[model samples]
Target: MSVVSDTIDWFSDSTHWSGDDGVPHRLVQHLGYTSLTIAIAAAVAIPIGLWIGHTGRLRGLAVVSSGALRALPTLGVLTYASLYTGIGIKAAIFTLVLLAIPPLLAGAYAGLESVDRQTIDAARSIGMTEWQILTKVEVPLALPLIVGGFRSSTLQVVATATVAAYIPGPGGLGRYLIDGLALRDYPQVVAGSVVVIVLALVLDGIFVLLQRLALRNRPAPVRSTV
Candidate 1:
């Protein structure tokens, strides 16, 4: 109860809402980090995944590799990268990119593989080239799962970005949590946690909408009238 009361007080304080170190600024910083890292991971991972899926070669390798990558500890990578890169947003971004890649890769390949073989054969029978079959058939169908993977990756990255505050530079909302802990300001720490949770929920909602839109735009199946 005391912690809740302190959190409310911390939020009520106007000073916490305004300044370079305020919630809004930190939120933006966190979003920037997340967006860039995910973008890079997507660019690198999706194409490779798609290619592997389309070719039907080395797919087991891709899956196993993604699983291994996902098992990596984010903080350990962050710490190691910071040691070599000397602690900054760059190192944090690098660590996050590594963390973000596996899901995106897995999603892409899974989405591609999930497409029905009959559909691919139908496309081929219709004189559709390999590229057309992929773009027009497989990709469209796989979109939901692909987006699901992206959503998962985004959520993970957003949560992890908070840890960037522990590095020696300006950080996101995690700053509030880290600083509050160092100073024993429990209220501030709680407030920071609430903010992070809210951000994750909001981002997740956006992705849900995106996934729905993708599904909604998907072409309806052709049915035969008896």
Candidate 2:
């Protein structure tokens, strides 16, 4: 059992292999982080998106920015954030937050824009306060779209969290990927890849369920057929 043979054997037996300390622990830790990023992005994006949709200002900026963010690769943004923020989940979160902004903005804008002009006028005619119009009419009408945006953002964040391993800290499943690539361990690479993809799908599935619940609770929108 030469060194190469030993490493090859280790790679072949995944059950016996521990590629980078505690990879399972890292995966859990990164999952927590991905959750936080979703919260933060939603907090920041929802309001901005709401305001943009409600007031109808700087929508072009939101449109351009979110579209651009979508085109940007997770690795590219991770690299940029790592340069500024050092590494770890901070960079991952920052990158994800940017990724998150576009959908929220688009959803919020679309939601608010979807509000009927006549309904707005009607609300005004009855002496409904501006705040009332916003909280009651605008937000409620736009709720579905807003939730969809969040659901979309959550899925994106879940996937992007895997990239955080490139920064440092635990490494999540990505650490295996990074280490496996370096050591030429295909088993670890395949395993890590499988874990990340499966987890991403599972997380997105939960968000979809929640989104459906939200849609169900919202009032059926009123519209004139004429």
Candidate 3:
């Protein structure tokens, strides 16, 4: 209870984002990195995942590729990007994107694969263009899995984005934790850790709400076998 009360107190002023006379916060920098991670992951993962799932033949490829990518050490990507890009948020984003891609791609592929084949046949019989069948029938049916992937990516990014703080150029809570640890300021380290956890849970809640609303609006997908 004291931690919650104190956390609220610390955030009462948004201007606390600037490292200043106060505790020297850098939350905004972390949020920026999280956003960059999500955006890049979404861009790369969603479409490729959808395509592979829809094809069915490529599900193997999608699974294998995503699994391999997921297995790759995030530190490797982070180190590569950080060294080549010369530090800062951009390099961090590159690392986060890699972290985010696997789940997103797998989810999208899974969702699409779950789609009813009969509906697709019906769509094709009714003179729907291949693109139309894909966009309307396949994508809509796959929404749950796609959103699931998105949720996974969101969570992954939330945690991994903290690594950016290590790359320099004004990091988020990681920076705070590091600084606090360096100075032996236990309270500040605890505060920054609490902030990161809260941020991740909040982001997860928003995505869950979105997932429910989206499913609620969509008509139930026609059941079919692959």
Which candidate's lDDT is highest? 1
Model 2, runs deviating above 4 Å: 1-24, 217-226
lDDT of 1 by residue, 1-226 (tens): 8999889988899998888878898899889889999999999999998898788889889878877888988878888888888967888999889888888888888888878899999999989999999899998888887888899999999998888778777488889888989999889999999999999999999988988887796665421100
How accurate locally, in lDDT, is each candidate? 0.86, 0.73, 0.74
Q: Model 2, range 1-226, lDDT digits (tens) per residue?
A: 3645654555467554443455456567667776677788778888888888878899888788878878998888888878987755577778778887777777777888888889888998999998899998888776767777777776677666666677775356677778778899776676667677888788768866865675676566632110
Q: Which candidate do you rate higher for lDDT, 1 or 2?
A: 1
Off by over 4 Å in 1: 217-226
Decoy 2 TM-score against native: 0.79
User: In candidate 3, what are the lDDT values of residues 55-80, reduced to their tens digit?
Assistant: 76677777777778889787678778
Backbone clash pairs for candidate 2 read: none
- Residue 161 in model 3: lDDT: 67
State residue 148's C-alpha deviation in candidate 1, in Å. 0.5
Stretches of candidate 3 off by over 4 Å are 1-25, 218-226
Give one clash count per candidate, in the order shown: 0, 0, 0
Q: Given candidate 3, what's the lDDT at residue 2?
A: 69
Model 1 pairs whose backbones collide: none
